[model samples]
Target chain A: MLLTALFVIVCVALGAGVGIYTSRDYTASNAVKPAVEGFLWPNPRIIQPFSVVDQHGNPFGLENLTGQWSFMFFGFTHCPDICPITLSLLSQVQKKLAEQDTADKVQIIFVSVDPKRDTPEQVADYVSYFSKNLIGLTGTEEQIAGLARQIGVVYIVNDETAPGDYSVDHSASVFLISPAGQWLGLFSAPHEVDDIINRFNTISEYIKKQE
Target chain B: MRYSSGFLFFILIAVQSVFAQNSIEITDVWINEAPPTVKILAGYFTINNHSDDPVDLVTAHSPSFQKIEFHLTETQDGVARMQKLETISIPAQSDFSFSPGEYHLMLFNPVKTTKAGEMISLQLTFSNGTNIDVEAEVKRSELPPHHHHH
Candidate 1:
């Protein structure tokens, strides 16, 4: 009986160790599904649902992204620092792409966390300063919040959470949604434009192979 | 040898004057560019006055534009406002600035777009009727607000 008990404890210990070793640094909130992998790379969080309006006041659903890979960031125009830097980084990517004469195969979308103040015109003006082709999206507070939830982008407004009274706290990752409207992958903060372009190219090749 | 010694003595005096002379140091400078460019950015680094007396910043001029003044931009309730301070005081043997949203060297009304890798010259006027010229490196868009900055 003593020997059997000792053996059971050993098995439990090994099982626990294995579980930890495999999923270290991973979050349960984003672990519901294994990210799809393609083009010699692993794609994270490959599919999510959302609905918002574009700068043109036109309805923009996830389905609208079906034909082109979209790069999405969550932020507002009033943001003084990080949002602009990230947007600037995207702008750099676009500039870099333009310099290479790469035909527009990608889309850059900005989703405002400060929906109350970032009117469609304001959002357009803010983003246009960085890149003319960029798209800004906003909607009712609840609508935007629900859509951000569907994906894993998190934004924390100041304690008040009231429009025009708080600052937004958001994730810094740049997400890549495939042409099929799938959440193909995400590039964590400290994004490099080259890496995004390389990954986009690699995924395009994979998608082509699949087709 | 006597002539060389005199020349060396003169050079030493010149060097001493240069070191003991009062100078203003500015760092982490930034400005906000919103509608009306009201919110300018200025941060990081302190001003050290080695002189024996206090120094006052009378005004600041940015060479990038015809108009560059000493102003503070504050954001409240989605509205950004600017305030012009009469003077910025830097006590002797002490430092000032290196603080956030306070005491900034604002640059605006650019004569033209400021490109990267170009040095910007800012003329700083002090209370002692002295003008110190300082230079700042041009950095790309500072991240939008929301992240912590000092």
Candidate 2:
């Protein structure tokens, strides 16, 4: 009976040790894995303060991005193909969230790289076609570049073939910012509705666990 | 034997002409309707060449727009750059699609504001002296409506 008792004790201690060791190993590996796909979890970049104007001609800076998730896309109103497709996808994302009664948690922002042509009034009219809740932003060339550079957005204004007619080559990725106003990460081109929502949910859950 | 061979040649020629007659086909022609304030729009379609000879799409024109050009949107290193394509050559017995984020017909300066469901006429010219007339319907971006899960 003593031998059996000792055997039981030894097995229990070994099982507990194995359990602890495996869990520590699992966590060590998971620490390096990204929180979610397309999310910069370990070190989300801090967004610097910059001045720009919203669709209403009101000054919008990093403060406007606080307290809500922001999905920002960089494009010009003159972009015929990719811009519209991306904006429409974002609208669907907003609509899906709204259906879940979580619409207030996020905001969609369209930043025009072609500030010379995209005036406040023009942006106002352009965004309304996609969604009434969408926020359009444009500023002077230098001001726009300041924010774009910080966010790693690259854009170039092409030479005009005719007067007032030109194209702007800009990044097609959609940048994600947390409610804390940190640059979370980006969703690359060819974004789908469900894929974004799924990743957003995964990131949100991960963040909740962190808190 | 000479007369029989001549008859066979005539039959082969007739069959080949029939194949050439129904070689080039354009399908899924549609244009994304833009806001009235926007001057540029994009059109998408698929061209299928069933003939043995390759077809080169040289240029396109539209009566509803001031200018139409073949523009290719290429995304490299996260940057989306657009270039004007002078001609798009489709190999024989192959299909080419001008879809979103790829090759598109860049329509500029619409003569009038076009709404969804409106029809626009386009004339696509080929290097082989063939012109194809297409009627493209204007469509809003196709996003699924809110799901009603009971």
Chain A TM-scores, all candidates? 0.72, 0.83
Question: Best by DockQ, which number?
Answer: 2
Clashing pairs in 2: none
For candidate 2, lDDT tens digit of each residue in A46-89?
99999999999999999999988899999999999999889999
The numbered model that scores best in TM-score is: 2
lDDT of 2: 0.89
Residue A140 lDDT in model 1?
91
- lDDT, candidate 2, at A177: 91
After superposition, the stretches of candidate 1 with alpha carbons farther than 4 Å from their true spots are: A1-49, A98-104, A160-165, B1-24, B27-150
Which 10-residue window in model 1 chain A sums to the lowest lDDT? A31-40
